[model samples]
Target: MVAKLRPYRRPAIILAITAIGAAAIFLGRPAIAEAAAVDGETEFVLNTFAFLIWGALVMWMCAGFTMLESGSVRTKNASMICLKNIGIYSIAGLAYFVIGYNLMYVDVVGDFIGSFNLL
Candidate 1:
């Protein structure tokens, strides 16, 4: 019987994982809802905590990507790839500080596009 079901094992494992994930979401709904009902100060603290946690996760992801790229590329070019990644991240941060915030938060009057003026 086990041999007969061997071919189906992959799908069975996937289905099991999906079922466990579904069960977790179903079970955790109440806690999620409760967290949504916080007061102003509690909400501020929660939002700040969430942002810090999210930022840490993003930093970890950057490191993971750097490692993965360095491992996949040729040895001679690995350092260049790491440098490019660092440069890209730095430029992205600079762009966000210079233009991204103004584009997002500043109000616009046109139907499709925002005002060209920077805040």
Candidate 2:
């Protein structure tokens, strides 16, 4: 016979969550957070770390898409699916580097769009 969990659920869940939250709060502080002053160096480090994390997440997301697309296709076509996924990601990044970079870094030449010069 299965023991009913309902009676213990409230205390058990609260204890588990409290333990996890305490651990996270106490253990998740990095060296940067310990800095005494919020200086340019700290700002720079935080920005760089944030960018690296964002890039890693984007790469992981792309990999997931590739896997999902490949798995959805027939075995014979999976290779094509993988290739297309990678190609699309590559082209999209390149396009962003060209257009989006220009949009952000260069002055907007047109009111609606960004710099058209191919970089």
Candidate 3:
């Protein structure tokens, strides 16, 4: 039984490692905290709840993106394309977390992209 299960375990381990690495990359970046003071309890609660909702919505979007792209593309290329999209998303997430988010929110230079702060 152990010998039979060994083949299946490698994929699971790889998935676990990928998830850990992605989480580490995301959490290691500097996050932009709300700078403005919360005037009331209502605002605080609303903001927190809004973000929670946004997280769900974004996850839904990822599913939608996968389905839409997979459905639209040729059958032969679907897996390859989906993997590409996943990789692109991971890279974009890391890039945005590290630089893009800060550039957009903090210390705006003008209407365009904000200045780079390598914090």
Q: Specify the highest-lDDT model's number.
A: 1
Residues 1-119 of candidate 3 have per-residue lDDT tens digits of 89989999989999999999999998887764544555677786887689779968986798789889899989998998789888977897799789876775576767376766666
Q: After superposition, how far is residue 99 of candidate 2 from its true place, in Å?
A: 2.0
Question: What's the distance in Å from true for residue 10, model 3?
Answer: 61
lDDT of each: 0.83, 0.82, 0.81
What is the TM-score (0 to 1) of candidate 3? 0.46
Which pairs of residues have clashing backbones in candidate 1? none
Candidate 2: tens digits of C-alpha lDDT, residues 42-99: 8878887898799899999999988988888899999998888889989998988877
The residue-by-residue lDDT of candidate 1 on 23-111, one tens digit each, is 99899677766665668889778877897799789988998999999999899999999999999989988887678766654677773
Query: Who is ahead in TM-score, 2 or 3?
Result: 2
Record all residue pairs in model 2 with backbone atoms less than 3 Å apart, i.e. clashing: none
| Model 2: lDDT of residue 12 | 90
Query: Which stretches of model 3 miss by more than 4 angstroms?
Result: 1-42, 100-118
